[model samples]
Target: MEFDLKKSLEILDKTPTVLEAMLQGLSDEWIFNNEGDETWSPYDVIGHLIHGEKTDWIPRLEIILAQQGGSKFDPFDRFAQFKNSEGKTLHQLLEEFKILRKHNLEIVRNKKLTNLQYTLKGMHPSLEEVTLAQLLATWVVHDLNHIAQVARVMAKQYKHEVGPWFEYLGILK
Candidate 1:
């Protein structure tokens, strides 16, 4: 499907509320439990989202908008949440996500982007050139991906408990 900025915003704007409703006030077990190894919990996912808001999406968009061509974006540190989220509570992280997402959406709207702007290209640190449409689409899908990640992590906590029923749960897979 074509990337429609307005439709993108409709989903993007709901992410925080969806996350908050799904996660807020949940116990530490739900907020902090990972799927073993290097996986992330719901809390960690939120922190990672916050990191992207501060470092990834808008910043890359600005580079593309400003450069008008071949703008090299600073590489994003995907693991920054480990240190940056230190001492932060899940509630605090959720609040931060809401505020940052709001501000970023406002910035996106302020641009008043058109089809030409959507076609504008920027140099990704690794992926070579990408269009604004691609970037914006990623921004929307990234939120969804992590939201699913959070759910999958939480669901796996009951992997063994669900026993025979586990086969029916695609999320645990």
Candidate 2:
């Protein structure tokens, strides 16, 4: 399918609400629970998303928009949230993410980028050149991938409890 900015923004617009709906009212235990492995808990996922909000998505877009032949994006620190989210509760993280996302979306809308601009190129640290369209598309899909990850990690907390049903539940596997 062709790239549709409006459709993309519509989906991007709902990510924070979707995250809140998935996480609200859960206890700290549930939010932080994991399978005692490398998988990220819901809390960790939120922190990671927060880090992205601050350093990844919109920052990269701004670099692309402002720099001729596009500037090289700073290498993303995937684990920065471990330090950045220090002293924050899940509710605070959620609110911060929501606000940052809203601010970024407003900037995107106000820019009123044309299809030609979406084709604009930027340098990625590892991937070399990338298009604005690809970056935006990745932003949307990245949110979804993490959402699925949060669900999978949460579901796996019951890996042993689910017993025989685990084989049938793809999320558990």
Candidate 3:
């Protein structure tokens, strides 16, 4: 299937809005909660997602547009990258994410990327090849997956009492 830029943008737009709402009214302490472990605080996850947006997602999009074929790509190590990053606050990371996301959306929206066919290869762990259309679909799916993860983390870290609501509905437990 070909990459549907319009559909992807729509999904991207909605995902961020929901994320912002989910994060609303959260104190910096809550946003930066390290309850999950030493590796991933809520802030770290946002940083990882923002890094993925800029370094992983956008580069892949570029490769797709350039139709760069048969070259090995490096999959992003989101956790490691964010861990080493120097940002001290979630707000800064979120602002960066917002900027990158907006720029990516603009690129997708303004470009004539329909019917484009390209192949991308990755070799960080092992060699793999994917088409432009497949990559775009993956990007959308990836966004949804991370958004759900953020919701799950938020529910666990901050909404313990209310989490049972989702648990009863089978969304979580």
Clashes of each: 0, 0, 0
Against the hidden true structure, what lDDT does model 2 obtain?
A: 0.88
lDDT of each: 0.93, 0.88, 0.65
Report RMSD for candidate 3: 3.4
For model 2, residues 15-91, the per-residue Cα lDDT tens digits are 99999999988987779887676667898889998888888988899999887655899999988887888898889
Query: Cα deviation in Å at residue 104, candidate 2?
Result: 0.5
Q: What's the CA error at residue 52 for candidate 1, in Å? A: 0.6
User: Which residue ranges in model 3 land beyond 4 Å of their true spot?
Assistant: 1-3, 118-127, 158-169
TM for candidate 3 is: 0.77
Q: Which ten residues in a row have the lowest lDDT in candidate 2?
A: 32-41
* Candidate 1 lDDT score relative to the true structure: 0.93
- What's the residue-level lDDT of 2 in candidate 2? 75
Q: Model 1, 12-91: lDDT tens per residue?
A: 99999999999988899989999888888888889899999999999999999998556999999988999999999998
Model 3, range 6-120, lDDT digits (tens) per residue? Answer: 7777888776566666675688666666545554556666777777786777677676555445444666776764564575555566666777788887877676664734344
Sorted by lDDT (best first), the order is 1, 2, 3
Report how far off residue 39 is in candidate 2 (Å). Answer: 3.2
Q: By descending TM-score, how would the candidates be arranged?
A: 1, 2, 3
